[model samples]
Target: MKFTLNTRKVLEFNRILNPLQNCLRMLVSKHELISLFTLFFLVYNLNMRSIISGDTLPTSLLPFCILEHRCVNLDSFGAYIETINNPYMFRQIDGHYLSQYPIVTPLIITPLYLVTYILLKISSCPIDMFNPSFQSIVLLMEKLSASSIASLSCIFVYLSIKNLTNKKIGIISALIYGFGTDTWTISSQALWQHGTVELLLAAMIYITIKNELLENKLNYVFLGFLSGLYILNRPSDSILALPVILYIFLKMNKENIKWFFALVIISGSFLLIYNIYYFGNFLGGYSSLSDGMELNMEVLSRLVGLLFSPSRGLFIYTPVFLFSVFGYLTIKDLPNEKLRFLLYALGLACILEIMVYSIFFWWWGGHCYGPRYLTGILPVLAIYLGLYMNKVSKEPNRYFKFLIFGLIGVFIIWSLFVQFVGAFYYPMGNWDSKPNVDENPQRLWDWNDTQIMRSFHAGPYAYDSRWILLFHHGFGNIYNKITKISNY
Candidate 1:
């Protein structure tokens, strides 16, 4: 077994690579690992950490209240709320200050806040919500937690598409959902309810698809739980519950159907009880939102604005989703009747969601970037895109397929660019505030001064660098202290 030095080195290199090669082989063969890799990839994009919507401020702090004070109300943070003075996001119910938005998202992310709280305590860093130095850390935590949840949606997207079509299409569809939509810019950048809703919807789709192929009682139970949580997360999205219930009713056996409804009732009871106790209504704080909605002649314009307006247009922000229309039109081509029905139901749900939001006074979704109101429907649209991608994968004509694929590639790139601008450069120019899009809804139609163009003009590096510096400054002090203690 005598060998020269070069041969010994060669053997050492191969030995090191053997484990890595096996790991790579396993990751490629297993869809689960590939999906997890997608999660890490989506979460690590530091450029997205620059923006946090004020709507998420209460959610960012609610987790702390839950962990430290054993309460959902933000009573302890009254001084901080006063300092920020963002009244739209909070509600004064009796004597307690609660989040005006859904509470389930904050409740779900509470464990993440707990982990960060423990780490800060271990590092001897002060945990003050009011401290300018610490506020960025809180925002960072919200960004990371939201990003993680949004990334998980991408995982389910991959799994669902893979089950329906193939691995290649699954990967492409997952990337499109994660990077080419508001999932990256809006949902992942803050503790918006949309991220949680998207995750639930994606999981439900996966469970439904998986159960269709291989029957599972637990899947039905999980689907019902998701449906209930979906209702509590965003009341506007509750329209989707109808389609979900119908799908289960049509497909599941009697025993499984009972299990499904039982879980739904159990999970939904929390919201109903909380609403009754706090707001004296079943809808909780969202009752006020319902009051602001009305059907009028303006509904037609709003419906058009939701799809084509410059500021909050769905197509303007994510044009790649236009293919979903094609997917919907060709739904009859799908072999599975159940899958076809689900797609049609989801399509109708999406339309209803748009119609419902169009009547709301705040259809532009406040100060945030892009079509945030449309975010809840993104998973459905993404599924439609996946369907179209699956069809494209099977296209027999080489030139026609190439042309179609090239067009898709261009749209995807443009969509990703738009989302990148939103993630890093939003609110830089104060386009949402100067005229106040809420006060003057007409600004939404101003093609001359668009949100995307304004964000680009403001530039991403300037805004993103400020966040990078804040993170460095906040974490650097903790790192220095830990190093000093270790040396001691």
Candidate 2:
């Protein structure tokens, strides 16, 4: 009887152990493991250099909307009057009190803030708006939201590429977006407006490439909703999306057109009402050409800087975009007109975004990493780059193969290093200046300061850089300090 019992126990242990071992093997062989690993990597980077206080600007628009739900931020009246800053970024109306930015971000962020507020209240914790604990909670939620959104964008890029091309190209495209670009730094690291824009834009491109609308009319409705959200988020960049929208409408059947139009109208109506209530104008408080708005004749210089400048260039920070140029060269070989038109619309959108940003005096996009204004179009670039990769696969020249792949590998490494620098070092700009007055007046192209490189030097600043965060002190110290401060 004892021997039979022991034999049964041994068999049961093997049964469990075998499955566990097989599971490990399966993870090693499949892309799911890579996906999880990449998500964790993004989460880790986002949580690394978080700020607990004093960084809120545009995001404040959200929490205020939630807590107050008023059209105007009445409290900002004194500051607006005192500042008399640029109307393009922020405006205080003469009769009504309101800020200039759109309400979509606030709409999304408010629910999260409310949930956090309620949880703290339920726990009987003292809630001081400026307290370290409350601020930490808010920042944590923001980081988590941004990182999760960014990760979803990565997944979308991966799926879009995988479905359109092959698994290999898909994985590479996802990894490139996840790490080899400012999406990791600007989009994932904090609640920058770019994070939300990147997420929504990536979703738009993903749905476009997924070609689900051909199968289901409902997809067009969904696309319409996304279109509305895009317009709400950043009206300037919305023009970039017009080509894509037009293509969708042209392709849609007559029956679904009403649904698409209805959704867009609903979104537009909300925007119109919000503007009227706040600014008493349908367009809200926008700066006219007389108030320093015009085509920056410096477009030629701006164009060069946007593509090549070390500090602000899109191609410098995200060199994988170079592949897109190659992809553009091979655009003629695309399998279908639908795919070809998709590329054209996306390309024009990217060019328009870059051009608009370049024409603005604040083209560098204020104290962030790597052409943040252009971040929304990155998914569009990555998808096209995947097509470029597919073309390369068919090319038979070994030397050509080695040259392209070698350049890509080197560029990827360079891009990752720059982002790593961004992740660790403090952004060095005069963030305190009033919105209208160019705070960091130094030209992006002329500015010689490179914080990423400076972090490597031996000095007091180096001691505070990410090198210390990784090597000497460790990330645990950040958590410990937060806990210690919370206790106080």
Candidate 3:
């Protein structure tokens, strides 16, 4: 065992790979010695942040982004996974919750989860995945999951680009994804948003290829399965898949064909398992848990909020992506075939998306479930904007291309700012990230961490301020002492 580990270390440190090569290193086969080394590096790199999350990082919502001493969504879903596995503690409804959670995200996580569990049990290892008590297994699983999310997103983007355009487009798209702001943010998190969204987008793209472009009707089975999984993630974007499904039915509008039944059965089987077990219903585990169904007179207000809302809307945080969509659309013509196809598809998707988003806006109040709601369609949108870019200046001068790339470069820099700089300096988020900032919704001013800290209820940082509370807890007394002195 000692020799084996020593050899693994040698392979891991053999060379420092560039970001692209480093990200793609995991494709190495399970049986290969080199792959094993890469895996070790991946794990070590993730655990390098142990100071933040007790080695595994909080799977919790607030802490993962903000980085506090807490485990993230484990309680919501991970705990559900645990409860189901523990037979004696199992409640039927609890089991059903696991079965049903828009569970597409959880399902993507299952393989790594199972592997960690198996290793823990097999080797009698006491590695806990959540706390230090279970830190060993949890940390290990998180590291693997993080890498998997990164690697899979790369593959997914490549496939989506390749399917929509060509090999070059695919490589460029994947590179953008690897380096892009949102993808980078999502991937780095110790939570489900990145992995889950990636799966949902991939599934949508797969359906488009299978039903419309590819000649394979048999492939709809995977399409339907992924569609069901898509619903599990954001549920709102599930409507977006209608185009692909409609494509499947267009050829056989009159008949309930054999392939139709196969699609239903294949997708339904997996989903039914989730639904019946999760929500005690055959079809509604995730939707049942969503915040959108209830109707109100002010549903009109919610609708307005959906498009322009501070938190969930497209225009809120990243306005450039929105402008890029606009810039792409206004262009007169696109020169290339692949660019034209991508533009047309994206235009159609965007219009379809707008219609659906409008319909649901009043219902859900703009999906503040993080920025994840709109991210599903980003890959398609990026290509759309890229084409318009080609059209806007049929020829981008070196300076213009540099300017465009540099503006994108600014976004890249800002992306790093949001994650690393924003985390420490901005903490909860900056002024731009706050919701309903103009009218100030909740019952106070700066109702964010600042207001909460200053108020009598005070919450976590009542004594100083959220800024002080944030770094202090992570730093323990050292931060508090410095702040305490600064107080003088």
lDDT of each: 0.83, 0.66, 0.45
Between candidates 1 and 2, the lDDT winner? 1
What are the per-residue Cα lDDT tens digits for candidate 3 across 290-347? 3534444655554444444544344333444654665566434534433344345556
Poorest stretch of ten by lDDT in candidate 1: 461-470
For model 3, the stretches where C-alpha displacement exceeds 4 angstroms are 1-100, 126-131, 162-169, 206-214, 232-234, 250-261, 287-313, 326-370, 389-406, 419-488
Clashing pairs in 1: none
Which scores greater on TM-score, model 1 or model 2? 1
Per-residue lDDT of model 1, residues 204-317, tens digit only: 988988888888899989998888888888988888767778998897589999999899888888878888899899888788776888788999888988998888999989
Q: Estimate each model's TM-score.
A: 0.90, 0.78, 0.58
> In model 1, how large is the Cα lDDT of residue 439?
89
Clash pairs detected, candidate 2 = 62-106
> Against the hidden true structure, what lDDT does model 2 obtain?
0.66
Q: Give one digit per residue, the lDDT tens place, for model 2 in 62-132.
A: 46445644443535333433443443345555654455566666666676667655555544444433444
